[model samples]
Target: MFVEVGPDDFSQQALYDRLCETDRASQSGAVVTFTGRVRDYNAQGHIEGIELEYYPGMTEAALQQLLKQAQQRFALTNAGIVHRVGRLANHAQIVWVGTCAAHRNDAFNAASYLMDMLKQSVPIWKKEWANGEAEWVAAKTTDSQAAMRWLQETDEPGA
Candidate 1:
């Protein structure tokens, strides 16, 4: 498992390739990946960009724990997540999650679980830039609902 939180942008293809190179890749039959990008607009208006902030060490530790949980819950062979911080323009990649497992279902479920949990539990904050002003983005109820769905489901592979 790998977890990274940083200001540097990442190449999704490179990360996917690395996931395929994991020690147990030959034993895994499926690999799932998710990429989140900054949208050009939000409910407020047209967006210029977004700035994400997080407490460095604390944020990474939280992400690492999340990865470990995902590994255990899904019986994943490999998993990795990368989240970008600082100012990012519209359409720039914001986050990437990859998971590999012996079954396609496990990989797909693990990827979704990681992204949903990250949005709801991580300590990252985002400030949206729009109409010549910036505002701190608030957590959406939809995000909380998404995360709750996983908790409510008892069909997890390793549960």
Candidate 2:
């Protein structure tokens, strides 16, 4: 499994190809991919763009820990995560997660777990540039709730 955090132009096709190659190499029967994009509007209202910031080594270490947790909890053959930083325009891809497993259930669950953990546990922060002003965006309650669900599950079926 690999987790990468850096500046990327965000290409879906390129990511898809890489996932396919990894899946093939790992001899997995299923692969699940997810992409998160910057929305044009936030909960407050309209947004022009967003700037993401992270504390370099800490952010990568946090993601690696999440990946380790996923590996322990799921029957995955391989997994990969890539997150972009710096200023990003509206509707640009911000994150991508790929999971490969011997079955669909594992792949699906791992992908969900990765996203949930990333949103909840990662230290990365976002600043919204909207209406000619910029402000730090608070973490969403819904995301925290989603992440909590995993902790509540005593034994994830596919884990």
Best by TM-score: 1
**Model 1 agreement with the true structure over 1-159: per-residue lDDT tens digits:** 788889899999999988888736367889999999999999966899999999989999999999999988999899999999999999999999999988899899999999999999899999999887889999999999999999898884844
Off by over 4 Å in 2: 156-159
RMSD of 2: 1.5
The weakest ten consecutive residues by lDDT in model 1 span 18-27
**Residue 126, candidate 1: how far off, in angstroms?**
0.6
lDDT by residue (58-86, candidate 2, tens digit) is 99899888888887788787788899999
TM-score of each: 0.95, 0.93
Clashes of each: 0, 1
Best-fitting candidate, scored by lDDT: 1
Worst 10 residues of 2 by lDDT: 7-16
